[model samples]
Target: MAVPEGEISDALQVLRRVFGYDAFREGQGEIIEHVVAGNDALVLMPTGGGKSLCYQIPALVRKGVGVVISPLIALMQDQVDALRNAGVRAGFLNSTQDLDERRVVEAQFVAGELDLLYLAPERLKVASTVQLLDRGDIALFAIDEAHCVAQWGHDFRPDYLLLSGLHERWPDVPRIALTATATQATRTEIASRLNLEQARHFVASFDRPNIQYRIEPKNEPKRQLLHLLRTEHSGDAGIVYCLSRNSVEKIAEFLTANGIEAVPYHAGLDPRTRAENQSRFLREDGLVVVATIAFGMGIDKPDVRFVAHLDLPKSVEGYYQETGRAGRDGLPSTAWLAYGLNDVVNLRKMIDTSEGDAAHRRRLSVHLDAMLALCETVECRRVQLLNYFGQDGEPCGNCDTCLTPPESWDGTIAAQKLLSAIVRLDRERRQKFGAGHVIDILTGKKNAKVIQFDHDALSVFGVGSELRDTEWRGVVRQLLAQGLLAVESNYGALVLTDTSPEVLKGARKVMLRREPEPTKAAKAAKTAKERKAPVDLPSEAMPVFERLRTWRAAQAKDQGVPAYVIFHDATLREIATAMPSSLTELGKISGVGENKLAKYGNQVLETLTPA
Candidate 1:
């Protein structure tokens, strides 16, 4: 595994000279050197963990252009812009480009003038594209977002299936596959599908400590989201995820109406509008993009301060992938989600009604079960999240549970009450009821529905009045989460599962977490924000930072590139804090590579002069 001394040195130089990083972060050195020595690797690093460097540096140190295969055509422009800003000769070929544009990039590739070439896996299906690649000298094949190759993965793309032929075609060229997150099972599947079983595997710890994970009960979710944006993340760039496209449009409108500049993105959006919205979100500051799972794959925007989810995610993998998009520049960020009883019932019903066989339905159910466990757990959210990915983590004191530890109370009687009600309705009335009707009958409500059904006539009816309506709802949700309750797919009625008998007969103990009160939850959220690891610039330097941002925005707009493509917020923060008086001093800052310093150094110095 020893990389030659010269190759290792060259990798470090490229990392310093081109990337402006003084040293490698954790396992990056090994990966970069391995790829530099023309060895295959499968890397699983956390998002914002400097993953791009593992391949980008090797491409610079090696002899030929690095070819990257990805399906995120929407982001190739930004990625190439950033690389080109860093002085790397990068070009991309995707459906978005015209024939003339493709010819220009193809000429660059054949002329050996490009250091990196980006392509969608679908483009490889075209014989002309393959022939064009064959005419160029390739240093390595880097499969970005390699997790997509997993058939059961959260973000599977069939085009990724074509990537397995890469190694077979370019046997002499080194190939490396990389993903920000992957469970061990998914890891095995990715390796199997991509023909990388023999590749050396490197997994970094799947912990994003700067991200404070928090989940709350869904109570007027739209208002809760509005409060989160107004109070904590005011004027910060962020993302809000909704489960449906309809919800996406509504949420985006709601935010915009409430004085937040927001946009909507989903599969239903026309291609031009979707592209425009994506472009605006990337290029603008303090804008929120409400979207479905369709949006965030290859986004490299570093200043996204929060990622909020209105509905429950179907699996922990999808949740992790979506939330990981925040704080890509190593800044403090928030990953917040709100869930409720209906979410559980709806997800289960969807699984049961899903278009799949028994095995496929079982797999989908398993993913949902894991997701529910994450939502209902009283333990640290980060611990549960990391555990799902087969990685271990200490209880991060930054999450909601650790901040305001919830109480786990015995709910055996409560469970029996709900289950008995369901049983009574089924046996006595020969009918089933949803959670609302069941809760009403149990709570002694003599409303029209109960009066019409005469549900109060049953012995169990009105017998369980100790718990309030919300408390009873909580019990039902937890039971469903624990598999003691099941939801019928057709009518969304509550039903008992095989395990419900254990709880009903007092043979099993049911434990449930009591959610924090409104005030307590608000205080905990505020405390988390206060206790966050600071990635802020000094107050004295704030003016300088803003000026630099203004200058950078103008440059970005003029050049038709995203602001981060010019320089990240983190880089700006570094510059302001250092208050470098000269170009030499500015070049010493991390992220100030040779090209950027050369391009923006005088302007940055001029911008700082007034401050």
Candidate 2:
């Protein structure tokens, strides 16, 4: 049945009044209408597309409290906090709350005083929780991060598999499962796992036009990081992702010591330290958090200026979701990556030796292939990344390729040579070699590792000498990126997959882009130029803009957040330049949402026209 036109508009009023959002973001209306009409939905919304509101508004307009199966305690807390702050009666039952607190929240939910109740997926399997849901008028059963239900998803959680039971318990309640990242294979698995086979699929475009995707060769990771900090992110909040705990520590310390206000966050840090560091980042302006993947699962910071990857993520899905965290406010942001052969070898080895069935292994190998294709393609990075998620569209000119195309080379022969090395290395004995050793054998390096192992005698050795070690590394990295090769996670072994056969037989030809030299000129240009002020601003109000920024920075520091939370620099610049004197005028600023206007809009006016 089609949604009644009047009801949809009524829902819009609720969205504005309770959530303070004057307008619905793209794709939100359709998803909301579908869920509110009592139908199952699989929503693939990009980050900051207002996916939360799709279910939140529906839950409020529906008959009963929506049961949200969520992933983390921190995320649930953030969600609940945001909802409560919006005047929505939302609460969550998670391990983090004390028993009394849980009892109070549970009572409110049971009394139907709550519009939404968040629960971890693992909690859903508990007989008591299941019984509670069966007894309540569950208007909807919503699963956020629904891709976790899939075995092939990047952040797969074992608990998510139990969510299929929600369908069995509340067979009548409409279920809406949502994820920001889901490839075709993951989409299929999510449907089966959630038992939402007949659900409507709301796969929004994954393109984030605001982010500028850039991948640079690993000339010097630390220097590159400092350069990014000094030039691109002088007073911005961003994340620097590293592979190891040690790297996170060293990088955070190095940046902090060099006068960059950075903090370290990784699994190795104590929970208190991690929380404190995260709080500092969230509540302070100009703070950088160097972390492992543990830091950003459910971060709600809207204006992360840049996301720099010191290590290549495991798959394209992982890469997209991680980078999507930046530029969430729709302003221009940068997505930078430092690529190297070590990342390739490590990722390949992990998938090749993982303890899984052949089908699972092959599935993983396919994901790696898509990731490799992404890193090597001269096409728009956003285009390829979205294409991986089944979003086929035109190239977005926001990425490096659209800005400046890279030099491409036909890597057919090089690909064949690399595959041949994998075959000769023996599939079962994968862990004993590294990319350097393999490349040595391929180019006949006469290195001790290759010579000692007699890999120098292999027929494929030296035949690929036309390429330098760096070039050969690119070939192997591209092969790994293309899913023809993988590293064994257990022993760090490089292993070739079945796809290697086709490439070696010349049935497949791969194109690879040569990594470009570091651009010192671009670095110089950015460093020398001041942050540009908006041209349209009134001349008299320039001082007001500076005062607003100073006030915003102080407010953000008090909250332990980056300045963007208080107001984006672009928004503040526009405010000062435009010189909006009233609430009406203030709301017109680019990033001034109703919540922001209500809480701080008057203060902005006061600061602008002080007595």
Candidate 3:
């Protein structure tokens, strides 16, 4: 579809006045043009890739109101607020609003005053709501985080299953499904669930050049996390993801106690608290959020400096999508993950006990296996991760492997020693203690746990002490990362998997990177206060930048949507620096789509050089 003739110029005004972006990102123009021309689309964009403009601008430029189905009430509200602040007529109907507020939004919809309306899937199921939607002329039906409609997704939502009704209800309306991560299976499932099998597909490359990916074997995860925060991410806007709610609280407390400005977020917190924490993270600068997987889905923060995982994520997709949240502004960011045998065991246990059909279990297992390979691979982690999504690539040359290659050694004997111990322990009691105690028994140390188990009397005892504790730990981590050993599900006990027998029988040789020795002096050389990134953008840019930022804030608030949903900071900086004057000139800026050009182009032009 071609750019809407005059609409381009108008949307650009909204873009400038509300978002301060002089133009759209690379492909956003084509996406908006396609949608504005009335066609279904599937947008596979990286986080911070300006996917929202694919629909947001079109919704504004086209005649009637835009209907957006989003999963998170908080995120929807944020987006709506941001939009309203920009002077667009936007509102959302979700659980957070009272009946009166909902009634007001409904009236606005009926009166044709709303430019866009965000709704939760569950609310859309109500007969009254369905009837109301039937009465309105929906410019487009946008499914945000469309991957959630697919059961195969990490963040699947059953309510998303009801979205198929859109095709049946409004066959003529254009529908757009957007997500940060979607593999082949996930893409298929999304189309199936949302009844968009025929939608035009736009799959952007998954690479986030700004992010440096690293996977370190879990060694005192808290300490390593603290080290990274102190060295690379101090006083930066970042998120630390844990596998559990309790861990989120503990990590937040620890970071806060250590003088970092951080907050905890999880479903376990009160709704008000969750909202408060989210607000703090978004509105305040340089705040870290220690959260469970429950956070960051649909969050539109553009300046996240890093995303650290305290435990291994269940799948590479989950990790990719989460890490993509960082560096949205096109600035450099980092993806740091710490994993251990315990994390692997826990993840396996969760999958094994998950409620699903046989096919589902098998599919999930495949994803887990891929995740394990990613954690264990000594090559570029980014290469292996992208390959799983069917994208082949050379080394990123920016990750830990490309920067510092670790020494890897044949771990065949050590693997045999560990597996032999598990076999002798009868598998039932294997997981009772940690790898250290198991290593002690294999190396013939008379520790209390080993002595109580009488493991010192076995033939495997004292068979392997040549490796130091650090070396043995490395082997254990590699075995876990390779899926050769698992702490029995639920009990945290060690158990040998089928792969363990292969390693023990010499059918498989394990290669593991040797652990680096710690230098006490090096560790103590710098404190948390010394580790923050230098934010050195031009001082001239700061003042107009703040004005542009304030305009964006008001626009976002008035529109009732997250700020980035309007225009990313990268676009804002381009607007500030390039100072484009006309629609033709503005179109050259990244992220200014045809619809965006029509609605926001003039506003940005006016902001840069007021009439």
Top lDDT hit? 1
Instruction: Please name the candidate that would achieve the greatest TM-score relative to the true structure.
Output: 1
Ranking by TM-score: 1, 3, 2
Candidate 1's C-alpha runs over 4 A off are none
Number of colliding residue pairs in model 1: 0
- How do the residues 1-611 of candidate 2 rate in per-residue lDDT, one tens digit apiece? 67766778878878766654567888888888888888899999888777888888899888999988888676576567656645678889887889899888778877888999999887876788777776677889889988877878988899988888777767789999999998888899999988989999998888887777888767688998898879777888899999899999999989988999899999888888888888777666567899998778767778688899999887888888899888777777788888888877776667766898989888877777777677788887878887777778787655666656778888888887777777777753343566778788877788777777777777877888788888887777777666677666776667777788888788988888876555743643353233223233577767887788778877756654455546656677777777786898777666565667788888898888877
lDDT order, best first, reads: 1, 3, 2
lDDT of each: 0.90, 0.79, 0.80
Taking all chains together, the TM-score of candidate 3 against the true structure is: 0.86
How many residue pairs collide in each prediction?
0, 19, 66
Model 3 CA lDDT for position 417: 83
Off by over 4 Å in 3: 1-23, 427-434, 515-535, 539-611
The worst-scoring run of ten residues by lDDT in candidate 3 lies at 520-529
Q: Write the per-residue lDDT of candidate 3 for residues 95-203, one digit (tens) a residue.
A: 8889999999999998899999999999977999999998888899999999888878888888998889898989989999999999998999898888888888888
C-alpha TM-score for every candidate: 0.98, 0.85, 0.86
| Candidates 2 and 3, the one with greater lDDT | 3
RMSD of each: 1.3, 4.3, 4.9
